[model samples]
Target chain A: MNSAAGFTSQDSATRISVGDALTPEDVSASSAVAAEDTARYALMLGDDCLILAQRLGNWISRAPELEEDIALGNIALDLLGHARFFLTYAGSAWGKSEDDLAYFRDEEDFRSCRLVEQDNGDFGKTIARQLIFSFYTHELYSRLVDSADATLAAIADKALKEVDYHQDHAAQWLLRLGGGTAESSRRVQAGLDAAWPYVEELFADVEPTERLAEQGVAVLPSALREPVLDRLHAIITEAGLNPPEAKGAFGADRSGRFSEHRGFILAEMQVLARQHPGASW
Target chain B: MEETDRNAPTDQVPEGGVVTEDPAEHSVWPLWEVFVRSSRGLSHVHAGSLHAPDAAMALRNARDLYTRRNEGTSLWVVPAADITASDPDSKGGYFESPKGKSYRHATYYKQSEGVPHL
Candidate 1:
């Protein structure tokens, strides 16, 4: 069923109109200055999902098993859908389309957390990253469903259901890889350790996010940290794996300071879109 | 030469006993037949098949593949090997009787023409 407003059943069947929930008028009605902050907040969320979706797409033919291949592909498609909605709504404020926001942005302009920009080293490493990110997204979206902004609330309401499945997918893989064999357990443990340093940056409270949270238009990242970490630690312990104690990467997301790997990811993703301007199939 | 010699021993069969390959060794995940209920009033119909490691994964895979377009409210997955079917050779004997039972059809009863709920 289509959850977003203004989407007819016919439109939902044939295609997804990502911007169905919000109109240009709705965005323009809000104060232009406030709209800018909301737009920036939306960009942070949109960039996170967009980058992770690209990472997940890389596993289409490369997952360890065929079932996992399809599973990851489905999750990637869902994340891409979420990214499109957020980007479209965010773009409305600046008179830009979803494609403009996604394709034209440089690596420094992206607001994705360091965790999502990290390399998907192996199945184990990818699962470790998915586990942390999905749990955090689950909490974030759950709270955002009640945002004062109707458009943001609608987008979050739809995205929250999909994130539930993503969390389950990552949790299942984490359990299996952690409990499977001696070598498997060792690799996944190492994967968790490698990804642990990036976790804290996801909950870092930046100025825009803080301002938006106060206005009831965005979820406070700091508020999600305790519950998300508590749930993640329990799962890690249950899987017979130890949670890593590492310092977080220091920097505000979307402030031109990004993880080292973000540049390479952006270069590959934007190459085609940048080469062919205003082109569509 | 030593590395090649070390691998060669594994390829050799032991004396007297035949070397049997494990059937599960080279097999992928088992295939599952998927059925989906489009809505509350509809019966579950066979949708398609997919490969998964277990029942839980099979169900999840079916949901992703079949219901991505909002096609179904419920899903069922059965291991392909568990289903038993009638032999094609016995199709005439098994299904012939129903063909000749014209009285079972509503159209065969002339008196039912005037009945509203018939």
Candidate 2:
């Protein structure tokens, strides 16, 4: 998701398009936040959006149909919008710019969940990933509108509207693919089974998460997981789909363990930059 | 919602009209028409239709299907059949006449210095 090539420029204009169309000025308005704290919070939220956006974008021209292709593209756009806000916030913390943070970061520098980095396996797998991520995002953004951090609050306020639509999109598809023809139902079940192991990693509490949670600059992913899973369960049952059985943690890392699939995804994702260090469009 | 007719149970819609039932009664969903308005100055325009389990799902589907293109500031989804219309082909019975109300024309308005634009 990081694009160092795109970050080479220093233009600040892209960061603050809010008043004209989409504004970053709201983020520029000082919340008087501590620089390091702001950077951590920004990276956390920004990486989440960016990684998810990348995953969804991979569906372009590969979805089951044209409508789904367009739908996933639209969802990716919304997530990219959110990533811009959070990365812009991160940039402001260091007196840099949004593109600087997005395109300049290394893989180790990202704070997104390992689940998001898993490769898209199939249509069912994509929806399974979306069902988990969209539910988490919808609730997180809904609570974040009231965050003490003004910039975070503003970003959340705007994004909550978009996420509301995203949640609906995932919910309907989850129902259809889960409850549809026998073939679809079986694949969707398999998708959820493959995806479920990574879900727990998203909620694993890290020290950075704990620190930001106290500042009201970050919502605790651990605290939100229960409600997220509850909602997921409700939707699955309503759709006549069985919840995938929980798999034991695959990694003992603090974020739990990433699935074996992640290395391949990162390899593909980072290849362009690795191959051509200074490449530009 | 496009699914209305599909989702409607045996009694939901009269047979042979939008919904038909097999003995199983496992009708799919109902279809609803979608409308959207960009702002106060704009009239609601048809966006698209979708199938959903109920009204709430219909609205949600409409929002996803139509508004994701940034086409609307607001949305409305109504069961397609709920919309009533007069048959244009049968309008000859009473549609041609204006009831002879000459005042309905703008010729009655006169321009004056006090009402320059009018």
Candidate 3:
């Protein structure tokens, strides 16, 4: 557990090693509470990570190879950890626990964007989703480190490093799959085509986030679009694949309106908690 | 080193496209040996092995396999086939020559009486 690099800590003794990120328990005990708008903003971020983690978790035993299986599982766990941090902070504002927010929320209450809820069609498609999601977070968290709220800033700074590794992982796979054999290239290209339309929904300015962005507590999602798109195009070209020209999907909002896959993902995620209330492992 | 007939077969590598049990697909990544440095000052010890397409991907696989628990400060991956080892069947010739040669050892000689730092 390496202590978070560049996170401001007034007490040097508390600092540990790399990857020793902030746990939700730390957020629970801390004095910093999320403001109303900041809570709503954090909820969306948390939900996105939560749903994607669920999607990634399905690959634990199903990835193409053993090495790849472990890689995807580790990534799923990291996303879950990020979700815990954000959800715990968000829960602070509403007198709820992280589990309460995660397990009890209905499909309509979830504020996650459509991109995360989209299906992991194949290994290539999953990698495509990972590329888009990780690159987007890399940009969002990079800017979010400077948020006016100290806790959000700290969480973002910590999550940024892990997300950067995720971006590298996805980009490496993209290069390999896009440039390998003819079949590999075709599958990965089709993957990009399947996932590209959902990209625009990620950049939409939704609810409390748009307001929080004005106060410097949350990043403006639209501001991240150009950089994420440009990098995606450059990487896609470098891998010898054409940039996807798919039109943006309709009804791209954080209101949980656009996606049909959200319910299935939620059912799987919330089942154990819902089945046996107050369950602890 | 063990000097048995079982330790002498290095020529019996399975040919490409002959992997039978994997069932799903035939493309098998090459095996890579992983070494991990536990901390800044420590030497990298043999961690484990994994299969990957290339050296760059091998490093990433090594990280996920050996260093996921923060057990390493640094990592190195080498293709398993690249590492040549002494033939275990010739261990008697390679290792037994040094046996009963006490005169070649410094402990076989007495230090100078009362010499400083002897």
The residue-by-residue lDDT of candidate 3 on A193-250, one tens digit each, is: 9889889988998886778888988999899999999999999999999899999989
Candidate 2 Cα lDDT to native: 0.73
Model 3 lDDT at residue A189: 91
Q: Candidate 1 on A17-62: residue-level lDDT in tens?
A: 3333333344434443228889889888999999999999999999
Alpha-carbon shift of residue A114 in model 3 (angstroms): 0.9
Model 2: residues >4 Å from true position, as ranges? A1-22, A25-34, A252-281, B1-34, B47-70, B76-118
Docking class of 2: incorrect
Q: Which residue pairs show collisions in model 1?
A: none
Candidate 3, residues B1-118: lDDT per residue as tens digits? Answer: 9567854435454554354466226678988999998778889999889999999999998989988766788999999889998998999989999999999999999888888987
Q: Return the TM-scores of chain A for each candidate in numbered order.
A: 0.88, 0.82, 0.93
Model 1 regions more than 4 Å off: A1-34, A252-258, B1-23, B103-106, B112-118
Q: Top DockQ: which candidate number?
A: 3
Model 3 residue B100 distance off true place after TM-score fit, in angstroms: 4.5
- Mind listing the fnat for each candidate? 0.27, 0.09, 0.73
